[model samples]
Target: MSHRPIALEPAAVDVEVRGGIRPADVRHAKETVAALTRLAHEPVLRATVKLVASPHPGERRTAQAVLDVRGRLIHAQATAESTRKAVHLLNDRLRARLLKTTRDWENLRGRELRDGEPGRRHPAPPEEPLPHRPRREDPVIVRRKTYALERAIPDEAVFDMEQSDYDFHLFTEAATGQDSVVYRAGPRSRGDGYRLAQLDPRPGLLGPVRAALTVSPVPAPVLTEQEAVERLEFTGRPFVFYADAATGRGCVLYHRYDGHYGLITPTPA
Candidate 1:
């Protein structure tokens, strides 16, 4: 399930610039948010970001940046003689939130699932916290293998997705002559359900070597039918995976960790 790119309300974010803040200061704050949106899209992690800029009511000396996700918002405020300085600090707070979110997603993706039984998975405790370190490239050891994708009926895509431990599966659509993708979504128990997103990366970043947008999509709240919802259910130890399919693009699924899940989707480079 993935949401195609749309103009989101960003109901989660609210930004207020104070009297001391200049127009440029607000611009910087938006720039910072945009930068983090790009950085957080590593193949291992993804997010849905919406930004809002509004007038800072009263006391121009203070500026505030508030971030919201899943109905929870974290706000940071600073009072400075100049809005630039205040925005500087405000941007820092937002980055901190993004950093924490990225770390959480990393922990989820890097889960050490011990194979206690044939198909049973047991979670491992997270590693000791690492000291603050700057991100610099330490040349990665690249590995490569190849496989041919077989055409499958849409229902067949569901079977393949469920059977695999990996988050995504590559396949061909029986109806379309395009190389398509199928991804899994859900940890939704009860009324929660699963979604399978399809994507075509024929217009990829590279001709011979193209990589699909490697993240699950985020879902917008919508009414689900009783019978249709019945078919979208999943049972897992503990993970949250809600997904949506945009009108065209691909799908996004909420991941289920022990207790946390975030948006995943494919984005243009």
Candidate 2:
């Protein structure tokens, strides 16, 4: 769709071709820059469009766009059979991201405005529950799925996790050959960090996946529990993982909601 005339000059949009992209697709994206800027509800500072081709047949073209609104970078991505379709999908995703960012900004601003008013005080902290209530949804194995796990070290895994834009990532620890996951602890905040966990299968269970998986490969460096804990604190991530020096088994160190560190180890049945 056409948008109101705005500054969508030649330098406003940058289309980077990795493999190759159709000329028509690039033209369409440039033409739609104004519409994207309007959706952002602010003057677009800069825009980057990336096109990459995949080996797969049905879904070959992947499009990614990064919009710089002021100092914030909003990202969108889409994959389709055709480059044109992927670009369109990318535009739609970018619009959605802009809408969400705008809403969140407005909400935060409203909270600040209210909190700054006279005669208003900061809300009290939540009361501690002696025993947590059970969740409404009962435990059920609704589906079973598996992915080939890639091998990586804790640091490398954390880097990959950050780049993937996923809450949690599963990989095989390069040092111990054990399965591990790097995950985020809480809401996005400045200095908010990630946590790492490792799985040591109980006796007779499968261990050390040797298969290549769909994940970034990273180097695994052995870490002591104390080192992991220190890393956790330094990163401000919720948890950390390493081979427990005492147990010789995989272990997880995490931050408990009550402001304490909790450790988990698998015990034999």
Best by TM-score: 2
TM-score of each: 0.26, 0.42
TM-score, structure 2 vs. true: 0.42
lDDT of 1 by residue, 18-127 (tens): 22445565566566544544334232122232222223333224344544333333344443445565556555555554454544433432333233421122221221
Q: Which regions of candidate 2 deviate over 4 angstroms?
A: 1-7, 55-59, 106-269
Worst 10 residues of 1 by lDDT: 124-133
Estimate the TM-score for candidate 1: 0.26
In lDDT terms, how accurate is model 1?
0.36
Residue 66, model 2: lDDT of 75
C-alpha RMSD of each candidate structure in angstroms: 18.8, 18.3
Q: Which pairs clash (backbone N, Cα, C closer than 3 Å) in model 2?
A: 153-219, 153-220
